[model samples]
Target: MAQTNNATLIRREIITRLCRLFAEGRLEDIDRIALAMAPRNAQTNGSRCCIHKARAIIKYRIMALLGFNVADETDELESLYSYALRALAGTDRGEGVLTVVGEACTSCVKSNYVVSNLCRGCLASNCMVSCPKNAIVMENGQAKIDSLKCVGCGLCKEACPYHAIIYVPIPCEESCPVKAISQNSEGIEQIDYTKCIHCGRCMMACPFGAIMYKSHLISILHQMMKADKPVVAMLAPAVCGQFRASYGQLVTALGKLGFADIFEVAQGAELTARHEAEELGHVLATGQQFMATSCCPAWVELTEKHLTQLKPFVSETWTPMRYTAGLVRDKYPDAVVVFIGPCVAKQAEALKYPGVDYVMTFEELGSLMIARGIDLQVFEVEEQGAVIPERQFAASSGVLNSVAAYYSGEQIKPLVISGLHKKNMAVLRRLATGKHDWNMIEVMACEGGCLSGPGGVSSPDVARKLFNAQSGVHTEMLVQ
Candidate 1:
């Protein structure tokens, strides 16, 4: 009873903060102030300290109301708040995300035991005959199991051929690509966090909904409300496909949130197209045959981990996300910048730059709307900026194809690399050995770029195809 009372109190506090930030229109301000308060860290270069603290206070209030155990709840709440702040600022990253993934992965198994009732007095003992490890035996005309001798191997199931054996897959074990999941003696699944890549595949695979993410919308809303500074939003192109609402309406909605202006990361891509053209000219002048794009953070991380050699080949230009923030800072030096997108990787990118102050995902943005009692459908529609025909580059090889379109006289060929793991490894090798030639290259981490990131709201392939088609048809209409 006491615990229930406490839980209610904490939940109320969280909701209350949400309301205050929205009502006061200070979400962005709070973010800037919190960031200003965070002491510079020699290691991370002083990111989001004030925002982190504000989030902690909220989480503590919630834990208290929820009747969470003081000791365990305190530790978990600290980590959750930290993650929440990171999400708001957009620098929440690999190791931390992996820890959440690990805990969630461990919570999915219903049970570990499977029995075969096919045992018969037949002397042939087919089940025993098929046991490679000799784990099964016959006793009292029935099979008595010796689990110690069993390896949980499904061979006995296969041998029974009678179809009496069952398989109970552990969630973590099923989702792991590196095969790093295993069971403890008590049947709980354990994840090797060190081997986990924070891909978030396990979180999607868990049927029990144990894997969860800390939402940072409340703190971010507070920061936005409190700051007196100019605030501009950089919207990722993948966002074009995320909501049921039209792209133009979403921009108008964000405008209502107090962002002074909205710029497409695709516009930054237009700049990237121009920049890559210049870089290609330099590569040609220098007789350097290989150069890679540096747009995708996940691909970048993968390259750092498994293809260190390819770092040299990556383009020195800032990614569209970073460059867009740079453009905002250059134009509005007093602006508190935020990146609103579909990626957790973008969160890490925001922390690395001085210009971008926060990273909020689509989901967190939705949370902010809910916290504020703002129904997106009810917002008055405002005129959207013209849908630029050249902006599709924000989507897929949209970058590479756009670059190709810019060159009229010269028949310059360019290479395109897509997908996170494969392209990074390939580009790393090309850069290291200087083996490939192309005037320019485009690389998106997911199979179809941002459309397929782990943080996406729909099926990756379906989302990518949909956006690509939408952009294609939109461009075609303009051309006609």
Candidate 2:
């Protein structure tokens, strides 16, 4: 789920820089960010057409960072300081979690298979023979593709012996499982929210870093800074693998950042799994074929928007985030609950949960730590041997394992959909139509589970290694 790229780094740099200003009590200086970022006669230059264009993109990026939707901009003359004021006034949040930064969009073309210059124009003419649409033609000693007739099936690309034909893809469009994003008439990408699953795949896939989410960072920061109410942080279990910190150290870090309390969502996962197990038992007793986990908000959104028929098969149990948020509400009743976890989907999900007031990503949390100069390496807790059930919630098929513990029926037959690509989605569609032996399906939007979510900080490989080695071993005892 993680592709190491400079675009993602640039976004994080902007987040951290803005957070630094907030921490320094200099929110009025927000307008100076873009200018400072792209100064005149810089030592090195970026890949933009001009330094001014780069700064314009950064300004839009800052607007998103300030919790404003770039798409809602009616005035080209609006200043960053104005947006910052609106954010502190608590009116900057957008309609949805995501928006396209047109200034930053590269306007990628529709994916097509093109015959490159490497074509041999061989006498065999396999490309012509394999073209289902007859869209391939040899012209002037090179193979040419009829773009008008080409359906992008890539048959010619595969049939050519020399591999002269290549398929160019729009990463965001291809990454979206629901086909919710597409190019407009101007070739700028826009999202169809009616079909979007809020997976953040398009946001993560866009190479130009045009697709961005309306951040709650400023709002949450204001709440923490105000300290009017208990500002609690509900952490996901995947946090153990992020920040290079042990569980105890993360709790310490949260407190250092002015969190009034910390609550482990894993603690709530136990209740989720138990309730889901009971529901599964009831569903099976009533002769249902299968049931899917509903913890992944993106997965739930997918079924709700695209696979309406499969919605009945999804479990009705509360998500760990919801249950944990409910627990905080039960205790404080008026606390400003902020969920800190690894996925962008949670930001949208939190709006409906009532218990959660805002959401922050692991990426943003890392930036927040950097802004506050809180290093994970500094806080070390004395190790103990007590096992924690909630810690297992981070890994793949973790929910299935948890449910299997509470399930009293026959041994659970599980299907793990690690990533929601087209091929994997076809499998889910097939299951909805036909009978399947598997009883429980665990669908994680991110391939390696929550640790590799769109809001993740580390690479999937690195996260898996760290999570596997550290799970069930670290936690703040009171909170976890």
Among these predicted structures, which one has the highest TM-score?
A: 2
Cα lDDT for residue 240, model 2? 77
Clashes of 1: 37
> Model 2: which ten-residue window has the lowest total lDDT?
471-480
The TM-score obtained by model 2 is 0.92
Task: For residues 52-151, write the lDDT of model 1, one tens digit per residue.
Answer: 5434434433322122222233245244344344444544233333223222233433433355566564666666777677776677785544666777
How far is 3's C-alpha from truth in model 1 (Å)? 34
Model 1 residue 315 CA deviation (Å) reads 2.2
Cα lDDT tens digits, model 2, 76-126, are 998998888888898746677888999889877644687778888999989
Q: In each prediction, how many residue pairs overlap at the backbone (N, C-alpha, C within less than 3 A)?
A: 37, 0
Residue 112 of model 2, lDDT score: 65
Candidate 2 CA-lDDT value: 0.84
